[model samples]
Target: MSRSVSRGVVALLLSCALLLTTGACGGGDDKTSASAAEAPTASASFEQQKLAKTRFVANAGLAAGATYQWIVKPYRAGKFKKGADGRTFALVKAGLAGAFTYNRLKAAVNNAKGDPLLSKAVAPLSAGIESLKDLGTKLRKGEAGDADVGAFENIINSVKDAGKSAGAEVVDKVPSASQLGGG
Candidate 1:
């Protein structure tokens, strides 16, 4: 191949590779490279990131409620059993995972200072997380009653409304009180 054409092709390939892989091009300066980890959050400006984090928090709040529903649907019929032990264990594990995600998301919401509307939703979501943890503990101890289930469901429903107020579609699949098995 001609030298000019070969160099052009090499440059094209290098640019494409750099674009696809992050931190690919510039690695000369130590100070700038150290700040690169914050690059994504920096690109949109902190205000934009605060708004995006608020939306992310709303979605995560809804997901935390959904996780409880995911584990509780099977247990609507009876208590924890020997065969159900694995499922119960899995549910509790999932609940803990949801807790971690929710707590982090909540922290993000708290840190989102630019948007004042997002702050209003924090309380119900916090209550929902507390109830979720309580439900997991009750289920683990084999002391979960219909009342406990009802309370968890109620807290999740309240959080769904709170999320909507915070500008998220959280109640898309949530049932009415009658559809919640009316215990």
Candidate 2:
């Protein structure tokens, strides 16, 4: 046999082996594979994620008030743009506001080291705020979709609920502290 013909046969055999290995790796439990394939693609569900991010931010900001607005303003102004994706933009804005509010609350809690309850509440509150920031980054990148959005919404709602509970607890603990008091 000619040397060139032998080399061609060897190359063809190697290609077939590679193809078999790849095919075998892909085959798995049919139900699991089908479900995974059926899941919505990221781009298709981007809007939902944006919505969750927005809602969380708004709720957090509302809970925290003025401080939230002040800290998140720059991010909102620079990162968000108006146009077709208005809803998504709004969600991100709200999330940013919430993050800022949470930051202010954390600072206030830190200052009130004498109050352990406030400090404890602030820790989780700070985590919620951080999550909001991460969500915003995802939104900006257009990476998150419906599933992510739903998850984010749940997280924000939880944060809002927690914030409300914490606020009530703080109020009950220190009824006398006026506007002059730390968060």
On lDDT, the candidate that comes out on top is 1
Q: Please give each candidate's TM-score.
A: 0.47, 0.32
> What lDDT score belongs to each candidate, Candidate 1 first?
0.45, 0.39
127: Cα error in model 1, Å? 4.5
> In candidate 1, what are the lDDT values of residues 1-183, reduced to their tens digit?
996567656644643342243222112222333354356775545555455445445444544444455445645644344456444444443333233333433443443333455556655456555545545445534566667656656655665565567665453342222222111
Which regions of candidate 2 deviate over 4 angstroms?
Answer: 1-60, 63-114, 125-128, 167-183
Best by TM-score: 1
Query: Quick one: how many clashes does candidate 1 have?
Result: 0
Compared with the true structure, the alpha-carbon lDDT of candidate 2 equals: 0.39
Q: For model 1, name the residue pairs that clash.
A: none
